[model samples]
Target: MKRNTNYYIRKAHRYLGLFLGIQFLFWTLGGLYFSWSDIDKIHGEHLVMEKKDFSTTSGLIAPDSILIKINSRQPLTPIAKIELVETLGEPYYQLQLMTGEYRLFSAKTGHLKPQFTKDEVIEIARTYITFEAEVKETELLTIVSNHHEYRERHLPVWAIAFDYEGDPVVYVDAVTGQFERIRHNSWRVFDWLWMMHTMDYETRDNFGNWLLKAFSILGLITVLSGFLLFGVSYNKREFKFLKIKKS
Candidate 1:
């Protein structure tokens, strides 16, 4: 009976390890990097300006109306938020749409005015990276702000920084986005932990499926099997650190 039990256990361990071997290595490498590196910034926090020049009445106004007034020829795209500001005490509004910046105008008149733009928003994300100099680039003006709506999830605002070539480097938002406070995400390491475990940066389908559970079981088996294959007797050695003696 004991021999039969050992056989089944060994066989089970072997197959489980075989199935999970590659994934185990992936998890090991990813976990190692995540453990040592600052990998929590991948999913940034939401940022909203507290110094908004918005009154409750204006905030209630439809953002589409604001966008149409700014650029009568161009149509207003879907946006995450609308901001009203007083530049040098002059009232103008900013439309914080998906990626590009559009000026907001009075609903009654289609008047374009000098106001906040994308360049100004990016300066907000830069402050979190410890960048000291003011970042003013027209190329970055084309950057698209990323907005994720979870509906019931209360997702934060995220602003991405683009290089001279308009490539992304980092993200920030109010809880982390632009023109808002700088809050790092190291405290929420699980976001990176999830990415490291699944190698899925753009999706969440990796967690909670039967495949992941099965693979986790296999990983556990693989770890045990390798140790068993070594035949390092626990009875003979008090601790593996102690050298064995030959009779």
Candidate 2:
């Protein structure tokens, strides 16, 4: 009876553990990947600058004068979608071209800087003009825009580390051209809470402690079994069996 029970226990443990093992492996690997990607962004030693409103507090330039200055440039084409607005105590303008829009601002001194240099601005204009002129061309940026969506979804995180001065982030509504703040939640205990939940972290009192330990043990067993399954060969014909790949 003892031997029989041991046999069944081992069998049940083996199968149950294997089932949990695959899921645990995926979870742990996914969590590690999340951490690694975040680390790269936070560890980088670059200071990011945001376009600041020197006009509001410093009294550098009046709003009306800035608009008149930019209008004089005449390099901006179409002139169909020039919009001027003041929001959150800052003044900015958006110029819509055939392709995408250009955002320009008046320097604190009331001098207008072309959103791009003369040459750079012309090249950007050319891309839009070419796209508009193409007889059969789908919008060239549609595909690129889709890829950007994927990036934001799959790796939807931005982080900045300590010791860097100046505004680390600039938030703007692409549609509205309004300056805003990007508020990031504090990654403190709440972050740890999530990390623990995803990683199966637990203390002795928590039921999750036993559950996670059991799952981890199962995961380790599964990895070992996988190696064993690959290593064990009953016959030469088993070469084909070992190579059966998973997509």
Candidate 3:
């Protein structure tokens, strides 16, 4: 009966090890990659230029006059947010309405301009990227999936792909006309490994998913069973020693 129970324990241990090995391997590999990879490079920090300060605060149009003109032009449009933003190193007033509308008004003249165009964005990208690389592709990104690299950022961005190594792509907000983020080969690998680490295939950000929870509980049980197996084997050795003495 004792040896029979030992066989069953060993069998369970073997199966459990096999069950958890792949995921544990992923966790280990993800840890190594995350620790060894340079975070700045993964984020494509080297490809971007530092943003210029919101140009000289002085000598700009009066805010009250701009507000009056805006109210007269588009009356009853409730604004959710407003800020002093810049496009192409020139100051502008960005208005975000509660209904998800974006408008840019020149800070100097207070005249509302049309939204960004791809042609206009090329000029911005030329000045934004640090290295001398030609633009490969220019896309207007309006929608994204849950696992998208540009998830949670402002929508309707200009995705400017460059010919630089690592195949870097820079995103600029189409409405705000501001640089958003950079994605590259290194970042893609990091993102994939991150999804594995978090075990959130849908969103890649959720830490408390059902699959991860189940694995964690099973992992704990496996650890406890290991201790139990160790104790059982130790007792078996003692029992065999006593039986030998009697014989």
Candidate 4:
């Protein structure tokens, strides 16, 4: 019975390690990165520029006037929210309709500029970044790409790249002109590691994936079997200890 139990424990430990060893290493390394990596740097804090406060000075058009202008164009829909936002020192009325549509109207001229042009996007990127370099490349992405840092965000975004040290990239909402996400090399590495950790290649966000759960179970078995093997070996005097005779 002792031999049989020892053999089974040894087999379980060896095979389980073989099955889940790589995953275990990945979990360990990924966990270390997650624990030690600066979350702010991972979010591309050093890559992009900080947000400048909007001026709330006088001579700004009122929300009612903007609504009046919107009403003149077409019948009004139920608005979910309305707020004044300043972009590049220009005030605009950000209107969200109950139907889940967002509109941007110039607070000074009350003109609707919902979609931003390439130049406009570049300007927006510049406004948000501290650097003065021109946008190296700009692409309108209809679908989420693998390189995107924020995979769960809404699609139809503008990918603007800068010629900075880290090759920082910024994603902006195509329709709303909203700054969606920022990414750099560090963030890309972190994202890849996160994907491996979760074993969710498609979405990279599902922590409760079947593969991960299976590996976790196997890992637990490996640990428990290792402990059992050690206990068995100790009981059988397999581990040698140097003894000193009392004089």
Instruction: Give the winner by lDDT.
Output: 3
Q: How does each model score on lDDT? A: 0.47, 0.41, 0.86, 0.80
Candidate 2 lDDT by residue in tens digits, 102-128: 545643555443323223322322222
Off by over 4 Å in 3: 235-247
Candidate 1 on 44-157: residue-level lDDT in tens?
Answer: 333222354434343334546656554567665667676654433334455566855444454334355533445544654554443334343322222332222111121243
lDDT per residue (tens digit) for residues 90-181 in model 4 = 78888888877678888888888767888887877776776666578999887666645756676677889988877888888776787888
CA shift of 123, model 1, Å: 11
Better of 1 and 2 by TM-score: 1
Candidate 3 per-residue lDDT, tens place, 142-208, comes to 8998888889888889998889888888888888787789899999999999999999999898999
Q: Which candidate has the highest TM-score of all?
A: 3
The better candidate by lDDT, 3 or 4, is: 3
Candidate 4 has a TM-score of 0.87
Candidate 1, residue 18: the lDDT equals 71
Q: Which ten residues in a row are the worst by lDDT in model 1?
A: 145-154
> TM-score of each candidate?
0.41, 0.30, 0.89, 0.87
Best-to-worst order by TM-score is 3, 4, 1, 2
Per-model tally of clashing residue pairs: 15, 0, 0, 1
Q: Is candidate 3 or 4 superior in TM-score?
A: 3
CA lDDT, candidate 4, residue 223: 93
Q: C-alpha displacement of 157 in model 4, angstroms?
A: 2.2
Candidate 2: clashing pairs of residues? none
Which candidate, 1 or 2, has the higher lDDT? 1
